[model samples]
Target: MIGKVPKPGKSFGGCIEYNVLKKDAAVLYADGVRIDKVAHTIDDFNMQRKMNPSLGQAVGHIALSWSPNDKGKLDDEKMVEIAKEYLQKMKIQDTQVLMVRHKDKEHPHLHIVYNRVNNQGKTITDKFQHYNNLKFSKQLTLKYGMYMAKGKEQVNRPQLKGIDKLKYELHDTIKAAIKKVNNITELKKELAKQGIDTYFKFRSGTSEIQGISFGKGKYKFKGSEIDRSLSYSKITQAIQQNVQQRESEQVQHKQFVSDLKAAVQSQTSAFPQRQSTGGKSLLEVLLTPEYIEPMPYIYDTDERKKKRKKAKSDL
Candidate 1:
């Protein structure tokens, strides 16, 4: 089971869409999460309007898709119970739940629509922490004994696989490289000898970044694709253990340039300064404020000092 929390784009009208996949059919929602007893199609839109005169044109939506493992044997009652449990666990009491049976696929699933802002006028923030969600789903699956995928690994949830086993070595390799290398170029050189590629891309947060890549037989070791916080030494060891294609010189050059540019840009942006161009001065522009009068300064000369001394002696 995988859950994705993505905000709907303008195409979906700026509404937030929450979706999950289990197996079989996909559910879609527009407004309150429930579908009426009389499942109405687009052709029956006009009839639905007459039957329930106050039905709004726009309805909030929630959707769910199914996986092959579900095998068309899903418990509707259990699904409802789980949905309610999740909401309650999140401490959402006022939210309404709507379930719609979708005819879209072979497997059975329902669409659940919920109002983020409830009748009590309290707002429910849609903050989906991915790590926490994964943890919760794992616990829920174990508790319910829902149809769990048998062989698949490295999903949103934690299931060990062949790749995960090798990840341990890769972790060490990446760390080793980071420790010894001065710049990206040197890092790429070290990784190339061991058969890994380096890539630099922007990650979600300003401080976060997608790290290097490595080649393993037919597969590539993308730091982002592999694991979170996977460092240079870790990737190197993984590549060494897997024994993939050695890093090419061309890849190294590209990595070198990328690292150099990022370093330069980072240093440049760190410091700020005002520049003076060859332009007119304040006198030339004559824009100085006239209301603020300039102060006058007096300089004492030798003659003035001598006269003051003579007057002082006479007195």
Candidate 2:
């Protein structure tokens, strides 16, 4: 299941009509208003909004969509129960709301319209509502055992309209480009090939890049707006880690080459030189160790024998 919470608008009648009067649409449930007619419902919502005239754009809208695989699992009553539970979890109490189920697509989905101006004339807080919407959607999907989408990869990009399409386009382009580049500069250059312009948001009076935004045509979005993983800090960390890994490999390769060269030089220096001695090469002398006579063996053996005999005779 997925939830999209668009920014509230100022038209209650138009929103209600679009949800209720659209083709194949049915109002499953409505609270805090008369449901016999759309005008009466709009009038009742606006009557409360009149109490807080200072607030503009007093409409809150949420769309809940289930995967087509879970179509048969949900019925009108169960869906209404889930919607009411969702609204309660979202802290949208004391507000006029209408839930309409639409059969315009293959999936089971519903649209929620509520008055941001509650019955007590207090403005319902919308701060971090987008983030909250995502959180509550996942929670309810899991609690209800609905099909969970795998991520943006399974999204039907062609079916998305307006900013949603642009967001996915940027996400796909930037994510693919990040894998092939080495740094932010190369990243920007690569994205530019796809007509995406990268702009850095720098801190005041400093050179630090505090954020990043991507623009294609007239639409521009902060990196975090597209997806959390595409944020400037996350991208920078991934790039730096990649760079360090490459540098480490290069250093290891250079060290291996230096060690091999040193080993070759040492082997060449340790090799024995062949020198000619008295017209005989050192190799020949070494090979003929037995043939070379010592100084004592060079003397006459006869003279030594005669001297040994004389000594024996005297004895």
Candidate 3:
């Protein structure tokens, strides 16, 4: 479940009627007001606001939306119970509130309209309400075992409206561009192609960058505003990690090539050294003639006969 606490508006009647009188909208719960009709309920809330005219923003609005995966698990009665619990946790007692369940969307959601002006004529504080709402919503979701939507990655960007859509678009674009970049300068250059201008928030009277923000057209958002992971410190850390990883890989590759060359040189040098020590030199091997044994002596037949005849005649 996620809660969106919009800025409080001045008019309670318009806000109340719109939320309660919508098509297929049912008032699951109403406190300090008549449920007979929408007009009476609006009048009741306005009368309470009149008690404390000093409070400028008399209207408090919160929309609690559940993940689609939590559809059948929550019904109208259970939703009202959860809304009441959420209100109690928010410390919004003694205030006129109306919880309306709308069937306009596929998911289960409730629109809560409450008077920031309490019954005792004291202004109900809205300070840190946005922060508190976020903290409490997550608590409720966890305590009830509701579907937890992963951050911006799972969001349907096209379906998002106004600032939300732009914020997510910036987040997705920046996150993707960050991966391909090696440093902050390169990151800025990459994001510029997508029309996102990166800005650095510097420390007072110093050159150090304290934070970062992105601007697209006229809209600008702090990096953390878009997504917490996109903050300056986180982004810088990721880039530095990439740099270290790349350098490490390069070092390993250089070492591998050096080792391979050394192996080849060792083999080549050893072969020639072995030949020089154990065998003839190249010059001696090339110039020296192979030994030939003397041919066996053979006497000519005529010469042999002549000698034999002479010996016989003398005898």
The top-ranked prediction according to TM-score is 3
* Model 2 weakest 10-residue run by lDDT: 281-290
RMSD of 3: 21.4
TM-score of 2: 0.66
Q: Estimate each model's TM-score.
A: 0.39, 0.66, 0.68
State model 3's lDDT: 0.84
Give per-residue CA lDDT, model 1, range 1-315, as digits (tens): 433333322211222123323333344332333233223232222232333333333223433434546645456666666656655655545644455455555544556555444544444555443334444555665676666654333233333234443554555576677666545567778877776666665577775545566555555556643454455455445545433324465577678767766665566656442433238442222333442334676646987899899999999
Question: 50, model 3: CA deviation in Å?
Answer: 1.1
Cand. 1 Cα-lDDT = 0.48
How well does candidate 3 score on lDDT at residue 64? 91
Clashes of 2: 0
| Model 2 spans > 4 angstroms off | 192-225, 231-315
Per-candidate Cα RMSD to the true structure, in Å, reads 24.3, 20.9, 21.4
Cα RMSD (Å) between model 2 and the true structure? 20.9
- Give the range of the ten consecutive residues with the poorest summed lDDT in model 1: 8-17
List runs of model 1 lying over 4 Å from the truth.
8-62, 90-92, 129-131, 150-237, 243-315
Which of the two, 2 or 3, has more TM-score?
Answer: 3
